[model samples]
Target chain A: MKKVIGLWFALVAVALIGMSAVQTEPGLAVGDTAPDFTLRNIDGKMVSLADFPDAKGFIVTFTCNTCPYAVMYEDRLIELHQKMAAKGYPVIAIQPNDPEVQPGDSFEKMQERAKEKGFPFAYLLDEGQEIYPAYGASRTPHVFLLDKSRKVRYIGAIDDNPQDETGVTRRYVEEAVAAMEAGNEPELTFTKAIGCTIKTKKKG
Target chain B: MLKKAIRILGVVGALSLSTFLAAQEEGTPFPFTVYETYADFAPVMAQDNDTTYVINFWATWCKPCVEELPYFDSLHVNVAQKPVKVLLVSLDFRRDLTRKLVPFLAEHPLKPPVAVLLDGKYNDWIDKVSTEWDGAIPATVVYQGGKRIFHGEQFSSYSELTDLLAELKQ
Candidate 1:
C-alpha cells in the first residue's frame, strides 16, 4: 500500500509539470531585452533585426493571412508601415502561424499577399515556429515594439479600434513609436486584443 | 356551407400558429444580445447567488471554437436541474452578424443563450474577462456564487467540460 501511494504521488507530480510546461508563458513586458532573429521574407530574402541599424526602433508584429482579425488589420498594418517607416520605426510583420495548421498563411500565400497588397515593409516567416514562442506571442496580430537598443518597450495590440479605423480612440503602436522617437517612455506599454491563437506545428 | 368552411379555415390557421409557436419556443432555444462596447457587456459578467455561470468566448470563424460547442449545449441540457447557465459569447465582427453569425446560429441552434460582444477595443476588456486570458477563443470562465474559474483553452470532450463544472460545483 505504501509503494502504491508513492507511485500515485509521483504520477501526479509528473502530470503537474507537464501541464505547467505547456501553459502559455507570461509574455515579454516593457524593458525586456527583445531577442534578435533572422527570418526569410516574402521575397525570399533573409531579413534580420540587426540589418536595420540606422532605424530608431522596430514594430515587431505577429500576424497571419487566414485569421479574420489579421485580415481586418491588413490594410491598417500597411498604412502604419507607410506612415511610421519614414519616422524610423518601421513595422516588421511576421507570420507566426504554422503553415501545416493554417495553409492559407504558407510562404507562397504570403508572397502572393505581399504582391497584391503592395506591402511597404518586409513580411517575414518564423520558419520553424521557434521565434514567436520566445516572445510569448499567444495570438496573431500581437505586437512587440522594440527600441534601437532591442529592448522591448511595449507589447500588445496595434490600436484601440480594430473594427473601425474612424472610431479609433488610441493608436497604441503609433504612440509607442512616437515615445521611442522622443526618447520618452510610452504612456501605455501594454494592451490586448481578441485574435486567433498562434498556430503550433503540433499540439503540445 | 360558406360559414362552415370559413370556421374550418380559422381553426386550421389557429392550430398551425400554435404549432409554430411551440416549435419556436423549443427549437429557437436561445436569444442573443448585442454589446457595442466592453463597458456595455461588463454587467453580464457579474456574480449571482447560488448559480453557476459558464461563459464561453468564441467566434464563428474559429474552427476549434465551433468544434467544441456541442459540449456546452449538452451540458446546458444535462444540467437543467442544476443552477447552471451557459452563455456563448461570440467575438465575430459586427459586420458579419447577418452574413455569418446569425446563419451559423440558425444552422447550429445552440441551447445556451448567445451574445455578440461588439466591443471593438479588446484591450479594454480581455483582461476584464480574465487576467489570465491571452485573448484566445474557445476560452471558458465559470462563476459559482462569487468564485470564478477561467480556462483559456478548448474543451476536448463533454466529460472535460463536465469535470470542470463538477469542480466548480464543489
Candidate 2:
C-alpha cells in the first residue's frame, strides 16, 4: 500500500511539471519566422503582412491605447513609420488589450487615438486577443521586428529611454532596421522595457 | 515711502514661504524613496537575509497591478508574526512622481514599504530581478535565504499569495 501511494505521488508530480512546461512556452525569439496575421485596422479594414509586398521588413509593434508607456511611444512610432516605411519597413501597430478587460483600448478608442495623433501607420486590433499570444507578447509596446521574409530580426524595446525622448541614447528598433538594411544582423537583438501587462480576462 | 514699500514686500514673501512650508509638513509625505538607477536599487533584490522578502514590481498606471496590490498588503499584515517582509516597488515614471504617484498614495495608503524604481534601462537589470520576468509590471519575487520564486502574473486572491509564502516558509 505504501509503495502504491509513493508511485501515485511521483506520477502526479511528473504530470504537473509537464503541464507547467507547456504553459510557459517562450515567445518568438530572434531568427524565428514570425507568424503572419490578418487583424482589423482602425479604419474597419482588414490588414495583413501580405498587404505590404514592397516592404523590406516590418516593425511589428504590440502596443495599445491605455498603457502609459505605449502612449509615450506614440509620437516616436509615427516618426519610425515615416522614416522606415519609405525605406520599405513600415510600422504595424497592434492593440493587444481585450476591450472587456480594458475599455480604453477598445477598437473605437484606438481609432480616435490614431486620428488624434495623425498616426501614419496601420493601427490594427487583435480582435480575439489571439495574435499577441501567438507572437508571445506579454506586455504592451513590445516590439517584434521581422524581415521581409517574415523572419523575426529583433525582439524588444524601441529605445533605451522610455520617459524622455531627448534623453534616448540607443534607438533599438531603428538600429535593428539599419542593420537589416546593411545586410547585417542586429548587434542587439533583444532588449527589455517596463510595460503594462496585456489585459485579458482571468482564466478559470 | 519707497523704502517702506520694499520692506512690506519682503515681509509678505517671507510670510508666504512659511505658509507653504507649513502646508508641506502638514500634508502626507511622499511614501516611497525614489531610486534613479537600477544600480542604486539592486541591493533590495539581493538582500541575503533569513527573512522572506516579498517584493512586488508594480506601477500606479498598471490595472492588474493596482488590483493585486491589496493581496500583498494582506500578506504583509497576516505574516506580521512571521519572518516575512513585503515591499511594493513602483515603476512609475519619474515625471509622475509629483503629479500622479503622490496623489494616488495619499488617497490609498498602503501598509508596506513602497520604493519607486525610475530606472529606464530595463534590459540592463530586469534579468537581475528575475530572468523569468519579461519586464512586465506586477511581477513578484518571493525569496528567503538561498531560495527564490518569481511570479510573472497577478495573484488571483489573498490565499493564493499566502499559499506561495507558506510554501516558501517551508
Candidate 3:
C-alpha cells in the first residue's frame, strides 16, 4: 500500500511539472532566414512579407500601444518609415500583445492609434500573439531588420537612446539600413534595451 | 529689504533640501546601493561565494515585476536555513530613483538588499547579465559558485523559483 501511494505521488508531480513548462524558443539571430508572416494591418487588410516583392528589405519592429517604451518610439517609427520606405526598406510595425491580456493593444485600439498618428507604415496586429514567439521577440519595441532575401541582418534596438531622440548618438537601425544600401554588413548586429514584456494570454 | 528677502530665500532653500534628504533616507528600507556604472556592478554578479544569489531585475512601473516581487521577499524570509542572498536590482531610470522608485519601496517593503543599476548604454552590459536576455524586465538570475541559470519570465509561485534554484545547485 505504501509503495503504491509513493508511486502515485511521484507520477502526479511529474505530470504537474510537464504541464507548466512553457517552451519559448530564443529570438532569431543574425544570418537566420526571417520567418514570413501574414497579419492583419490596421486598415483591415492582411499584409504579408511577400506583399512587398519589389522592396529591398524590411524593418520588422514588434511594438505595442500600452508600453511606455513603445509609446516613446511611436514618432520615431513613423519618421523611420518616411525616411526609409522610399529607400526600399519599409518599417512593418506589429502589435504583439495578446488582447485578452493587454486590452490597450487590441486591434481596435491599434487602428485608432494608427489613424490618430497617421502612420506611414503598415501597423499590423499579430492576432493571438503567435508571430512574436516565432520571431523570439520578448519585449515591445524589439526590432529585427531583414534583408532583401528575407535574411535577418540585425536584431535589436532602433538606437542606443530610448528616452530622448536628441541624445541618440548611435542609430542602430538607420545604420543597418544604410549598410544594406551600400552593400556592407552592419557593424553591430545585436543590442539590448529595457522594455515591457510582450503580454501573452494567462495560462490556466 | 533686498538683503532680508535674500536671507529668507536661502533659509527656505536650506529647509527644503534637508526635507528632501530626510525623505530619501526614510524611503529605502533595505540596504540599497546605487551603481552609476556596470563596472561597479559586475563584481556583484560574479561573486564566487557559497551563498546562492537570487538576483531579480525589476522596476516600479512594470506590472508583472511588481506582482512577482513578494515571492522574492518571501523567499528571502523563509529560506533562512539555506545560504541564500536575494538581491533586487532596480532598472528604474536614475531620474526616477527618488520620485518613483523610493516611494514604491516605501509602500511595499522588501527583505532583500536592493540596488539601482544607473548605467547608461544598456547594450554594453545586458549581454553580461545574460546572453539569453532580450532586455525584458522581471528576469531572474540564480547563481551559486559558478553554476548559473537565467529566466526571462515572472515566477508565478515560490515553488517555481525554488525548483530553479535546486536545479542550479545540481
Best by DockQ: 2
lDDT of 1 by residue, B33-126 (tens): 8888878888778867888899999999997799899999999999899888899999998788766876676556689999999877788788
* Superposition error at A145 for model 3 (Å): 1.0
Q: What TM-score does the first chain of candidate 2 have? A: 0.89
Per-residue lDDT of candidate 1, residues A1-204 (tens digit):
999999999999999999989975655778889889999999899999999989888999999888888888999999999898898889999999889988999999999988988988999999998889889888888999998888999999889887898999899999888877777889999888888888765455
DockQ of 1: 0.60
TM-score versus the correct structure, for each prediction: 0.84, 0.87, 0.83
Clashes of 1: 0
Which ranges of candidate 2 are over 4 A from the true structure?
Answer: A1-26, B1-29
Residues A1-204 of candidate 2: C-alpha lDDT, one tens digit per residue:
999999999999999999979977856878889889899999899999998889999999999989999999999999999999999999999999999989999989999999999999999999998899889998989999999899999999999998999999999999999999899999999998889899999897
Going through the candidates in order, their DockQ values are: 0.60, 0.65, 0.54
Can you rank all candidates by lDDT, best first?
2, 3, 1
- Superposed by TM-score, candidate 2 places the C-alpha of residue B49 at a distance from the truth, in angstroms, of 2.0
lDDT of 2 by residue, B1-170 (tens): 99999797767656654554455578744557778888999888888978899999998888789999999888888889988999999998887877777667655668899999888888899999988899988899999877998989998898888888778867
RMSD of each: 8.7, 9.3, 9.9
Q: How does model 3 do on interface RMSD, in angstroms?
A: 1.1
Give the better candidate number (1 or 3) by DockQ.
1
Q: What is the TM-score of chain A in candidate 3?
A: 0.87
Question: Runs in model 1 with CA error above 4 Å?
Answer: A1-26, A201-204, B1-31
